[model samples]
Target: MASPADDKESTPLLFSPKGGGHLDPANNGVSDGPRRRAAPPPQPLETHYFASKFDPPQIAKVSTNSSKYRSENLATPIVKKIYSSYSIIKDAIQPMTKPSLADEKRQGKIYYEDTYNDLPWRCSCGTHHKDGIWLNHSDKAGLVMSSLVWLMIVYAGFTVTLLVNNNSLPSHVGVIYCTLCALALASHAKTALTDPGSIPKRAIPNEDNASDPTVKFCNLCETYKPPKSHHCRICDRCISGMDHHCPWMNNCIGTANLKHFFLFLIYVWTASAYALVIFGMNYFLCNSEECIFPTGLVALVRLMTFMCVGALIFTSNMLMSVFWGIMTGMGTIDRMKKQEDKTFDESEEEPMAFTDIFGIGSYFTWFLPIDPIFNDYDSVMGYSNAERLQRERSTLV
Candidate 1:
């Protein structure tokens, strides 16, 4: 220790003023050395890139204090409301934009192209048909045969009701003949117009059952054929439970229209028989004086007689074949192929088999031209793949 004044003079100052040197008492509190300018206040990092050739490239430092960037990030009340509204609208319209698989299936638009586009007509039960009303453009022979049958019916009806005996036939006789003819025509129309249980082209029951041995693929229709379905060349499609192509009706007899076909045969046969019996009664039982006939009338009668006989023979054979098929549980095609016949125990199974074709309905309804109760896409196919699997599982247990 020195004295306090000497010690203060010897001690170095921690901070200098604007000048580089400390204050000196001999200079009257002024900086002793050269005066130095003040260093500028520290500026923001504006000059980020290095312009010197020797220096490496430097990354530009971004300022977080930018008004433009800050405005974008700011969540005002309007922005929040707009974002919430956009989210709600997106959620609301998502369902209509993306339909579910079950909804598509119910619309009948799944897997297959629109077949009803070209076919504008629908049946009584809302089934689409390519052939409108009664005409089949593909079968000219059927058209000719159908026309001939109609001609026969008209001629026979006219002869029995109005021409024979100068329209002296009883009102009930005409009524009966007309009723039979009407029923026959109705059944015929129904048979001709009804779809023959056609399978949808390119329909696949299941992707998993692709390897199943029983599921046969049709090259022509490009579809998997279900059990008992056959490809009909005339119809140019696969028909479920196909019996045969009928020239008279100009339609394939199959699961959907077989009932109408059977009824057609029955009504035609009854009408023909009634006409024949009436003709016989008028000709054979009448007195010669009372029933004298003109040469033209006699010729007409003879021609109609032959027609009646022919119709009787044709209808009888068809009825027999139909009955055989019903009893044997085989269609005409199945019978022709000689597939192993299913034995018919008439006592126990006949009614079931009969009702299977005609439908489980009142006896009176069976004769009428009505749609079959079980005639549908699912029923015609017997069962779906899932149902079939379930049935097999149940049977195994």
Candidate 2:
């Protein structure tokens, strides 16, 4: 009853041709050619949200394989890249901000307290106060180990001397051996008891000389640091011409005590070598039947032999290291830090270097455990006595 154009308009097409085929309502919502099922209703897209600023922005992901929603997820990678770049930029600039005082305290950046305060004994040395002959009380383990080493040395020396006395060896041989042991013990004591040229705690640099290249600030000690000086955490102080901290000595090897440390090595090596030679000769030359050793004596001899061998090996290596350091004009710390002494001229300064550590005296004196005499003692201390006097005068004024 209706025209084809009128019929098409009145038919109310449920599906377009682009959607596969047109559906006719007149055929009960069925396709004109073949029947086609109705498409399901569109579901809501799932979205992921990130809490951090550095994380990617929220993105919707459709369950269906629709390209339209997939295009939205593409922006997620770009947004993430932007956030990551911003985070990196922020981190790079954060350190530029000066830290507050509270921040420093929280981070353990506060200045250290006076190292010598409340000590049992203190002595005035020229313009500064120094600790007495007592070993460092802070390090109990080091103290115990050092005591054990001293006892071992004494025991070994006694045993060796007794062996020499009982044997047909000359009394002078025993005397010389005892002298070597005494020297070694003395040197060890000097090394342990002497202050390793510790810089005065809380020493302030003169305002006029604040720009001096040799004067630097120590954050931990909160004091002026002299050239070639370093902070020893164990000693809790700055040491002038710091070489290394020796746990065996329960002290640091620095400008003041380096000579004693070196001499200790020398004497220990000499004594150990002497003992080994004497022990060897007594064992090989003496008749086993006539030269009978008691069980306790034999045990003591074996222990001394072990001690001698260990001392020989350790002292030899340490001596070589000291020689190397002298030749190069560098300390263990300097070598470790790879800091080269620009002023060092090996050929010309070699003799001077020896004197610097051992003091200005006879070569024999260098081998003795004695305080070194520097040409410029004030220079070794990092500040001149003249400067101190001037500062004092100004303060008085």
Candidate 3:
């Protein structure tokens, strides 16, 4: 409602800190009645403070965090080097343990063992390896000696029998039986003494990664072996399931020819019995006249030798047979006990009869070839007589 010029003059400008502005009564302007003093300017405080994003002031915490981190990073290699140095010193100070008295004794005795094959001494694997059937060169020599002695006895008896009885066996027949039997017996004995048959580490399984403690205990051989298998330091071969090495046969007898050896024992026993019977009959039939028969001295000597030899052969055979039978029985019992100790229905069953340590009979059947009739060729040679015959027949055909 007022004029535009009056309206513009009545409006007041806002006050600012830079300079005072024109005022109107409507917006805190002075009246014409009395003059008023301006309010004193706000006084500055005695002290002032400020804070920044990079630096806080109130808490004067001088931080060593950066330096601490840097120091720790630098110390890593030093700490590691110090530890390594200390470890070396500690190792140098530790004394080596001396071998035990038992170990020393075992080492000393091996030198005088007489036989090439070591007796089943206690191995480091904690197994008592008493089952030694190793045959060494000495054994082979013994076999040859035994066969010679046996032949002498047989020949002497046969010659005496021809005089006593009108009817007599052919010379060739006696020779053939003696020769064949001697060879068979020698071979069988040798086999019994050697051939560990596959795995011979002390109680070591054939499975991959198998471990046994006794394997390292062979001081004489200086190698690890499974239980029942020993290293013949002389032979330098680990025999599988080694019973023992027999020097008389010059062979290591293991699981392979155990049966043949037993058969040889039986044969010796029978042969000895036959010799005893003939010698006894001849001794009684010769009349006690003229201070002794003309041929009586020789007969008497032959009879005495036959008696002595037969007794030795018979006794040895009996003892060996008993020993082997006992071993087999004990082995079977142990296997059964193991099976029983495990779960009632565990899949692991007792191994079959004649099963070697491998839980398989393949080694004996194929490798050793035990049957004299079936295995006509030499087991060592690995060829059957049938194969030879087949070849010959093929050529002929």
Candidate 2 Cα misplacement greater than 4 A, ranges: 1-130, 202-214, 285-292, 339-352, 385-397
Q: Candidate 2 lDDT, tens digit per residue, 1-397?
A: 6665333421113222332334466665443321222343233232122222331123433555788767777889999999999999999999655465457679987532222334456553221244445357688787887897799789976886776666645578878888988998899998888888877655655444456876686887776787668988888878877888888888888888888999999998998998899878778887765466656689888888999999899899999888877777667787666535555445653322666788888888877787878875654555443345454556667
Best first by lDDT, ranked: 2, 1, 3
Error in Å for residue 239 of model 2: 0.3
- Residue 378, candidate 3: Cα error in Å is 22
Best by lDDT: 2
Q: Model 3 off-target regions past 4 Å? A: 1-204, 207-224, 233-236, 285-297, 300-304, 307-397
How much does each candidate deviate from the true structure in C-alpha RMSD? 19.0, 20.3, 30.5
What are the clashing pairs of model 1? none
Q: What tens digits encode model 3's per-residue C-alpha lDDT throughout 149-210?
A: 45654565555445444333335544544544465455454454434343333322322213
Model 1, 132-200: lDDT tens digits are: 453355767877887777777878777766554464466788889888888888888888877777776
> lDDT of each structure?
0.68, 0.70, 0.44
Instruction: Compare candidates 1 and 3 on TM-score and give the better one.
Output: 1
Judge candidate 1 against the unseen true structure and give its global Cα lDDT, from 0 to 1. 0.68
